[model samples]
Target: MAKIVVALGGNALGKSPEEQLELVKSTSKSLVALIQKGHEVVISHGNGPQVGSINLGLNFAADHEQGPSFPFAECGAMSQAYIGYHLQQSLQNELHDLGIDKPVVTLVTQTLVDKEDEAFANPTKPIGLFYDKETADKVSEEKNYTFVEDSGRGYRRVVPSPQPIEIIEQTSIETLINAGNLVISGGGGGIPVYKDNNGDLHGVDAVIDKDKSSALLAANLKSEQLIILTAVDYIYINFGKDNQEVLTEVAVDEMKKYIDEDQFAKGSMLPKVEASLQFIENNPEGKVIITSLEKLDDALEGKVGTVIKK
Candidate 1:
């Protein structure tokens, strides 16, 4: 059985807590199926909506002076715990129903990033709830937060999207996986961190792309496949256009060419493809499968989605 790292998109998780739990129940079934197929599973998930909700709640509390101010990193950790909690409970129950006994654990992971990354100078990753122009402007002015209109869906707080240099809990994660456990780690890009002048690790107010972080994690673990579950069934070129084409199978170099041509959208399919390439670069024999959660089984069986290989 192959060891697989599955990177789940935040969009796949519903917006509200109730919705998230229900969606995760379904997600757990899919993961259990993989386990039944004899594959070892390690899950890493995006936390855009969850962390945004936390940040919004913390911002509201801070605005009202209801409690101590919570930093972005703290909010990330909170998101990770809540999300992992849901996954752990759901997956465990699903495993029990399927009569497959296995231990599932979540690690509040930390990912090291470069302090000199250019993204730090220009924060572009958007988070938190969307707000109208007036509210957005007020928050930006009062809190010195950078706001950007996201796809005309109102304004959102933007932060740096840094590259992950290392997974701090890589050894622990490996140990868990080696022990035949279903591991979930690196939620919200593992709490973005950087080394300070004293060579001490410090949590930074930044967001790392989940796909990129997952790729790094999978490569470090020497996984044979990196499965990225998103909202789309397959990677498409000329997306949204009438002439849109679906790519069922793509070579790593060919995918890079499409990226150079800007075939994918930033903050979406682009990063997924980039992460796939990153993992393949680190592990030449590795492959990446990009598909929707519903199509995961089909994708694994070569029935659907995009597959990138060296």
Candidate 2:
């Protein structure tokens, strides 16, 4: 049995609460399979859409005098609880059905980020509900927000995506895992927090890439493997094109070259590959698999997916 940190993709989790529950029901089966195979699983997941929806609803309510105002960081915190509850419920149901005695727990994890990180100067991550140009401008004016037209879908508020340096709740996570519990931590890349001069932690108005945080969590736990379960079956060069080619096994140096060539999309696969590189660099003996949740079984058997290693 090996210690593995698995980062579940946000897209795979579904966009709405109702859909998320249904999707996670199926997701729980795959995860329990890993447990059946004797892997110690530490689960992490992205909350981009969930957090954005929470923030947007909060803002809308506040604007309409229906609810009190809340900060984006608090919205991130709410999202962690919201998503975690669903996952915990679904995982528990599946485990009970299989007569598995493992306890499933969701920790409201916090990740530390550098306040002086260059990412703060450039806000590239988009969030919240999309709006028409006029409405976007109006909301931007009222709320003093930054909006960018997202791939012609509509305008969306953008936020800084800082890198995660450490997982604050790692000790607790380790304890849970060592006690034979399946733990879910590092939600929404850990509510993006920073330490003040007084060494007090405060939430930052930013998003930390979940993949990066998952890698950090894996490194912190000294996990033997990092499995990123995404929508893609395999990482491919020139993805969605006629010249596309799947990468079955990638060495650190080779992946770095591809990254330097800008072969991956900045908003998509790039972060996953970069995170894979980071985890491999930190834990040279460990390996990372990038594959869809549906193909997780095959991927574990080395029949499908891209595997990154030292």
- Candidate achieving the largest lDDT: 1
TM-score of 1: 0.93
Q: State TM-scores per candidate.
A: 0.93, 0.92
Task: List runs of model 1 lying over 4 Å from the truth.
Answer: 130-143, 149-155
The whole-model C-alpha lDDT of candidate 2 against the native structure comes to: 0.86
- Please give the TM-score that candidate 2 achieves against the real structure: 0.92
Candidate 1 per-residue lDDT, tens place, 1-310, comes to 9889999887678778898899889888888988998888899999877787888787789789997777778888999999999999999999999888799999999999998999999987777777899999998998899988764467888888899999999999999988878999999889999999898999888888899999999998899999999888999999878999999889988998999999987756888899999999999999999999778878878999899999
Weakest ten-residue segment in model 1 by summed lDDT: 148-157
Determine which window of 10 residues in candidate 2 has minimal summed lDDT: 149-158
**Cα deviation of 17 in candidate 2 (Å)?**
1.2
Clashing pairs in 2: none
* Model 1: lDDT of residue 223: 94
How many residue pairs clash in all the candidates, one count each? 0, 0
lDDT of 2 by residue, 189-303 (tens): 8888999999999988887888999999898888899999877898888776789899999899999999998888665588899999999889999999999877877888999
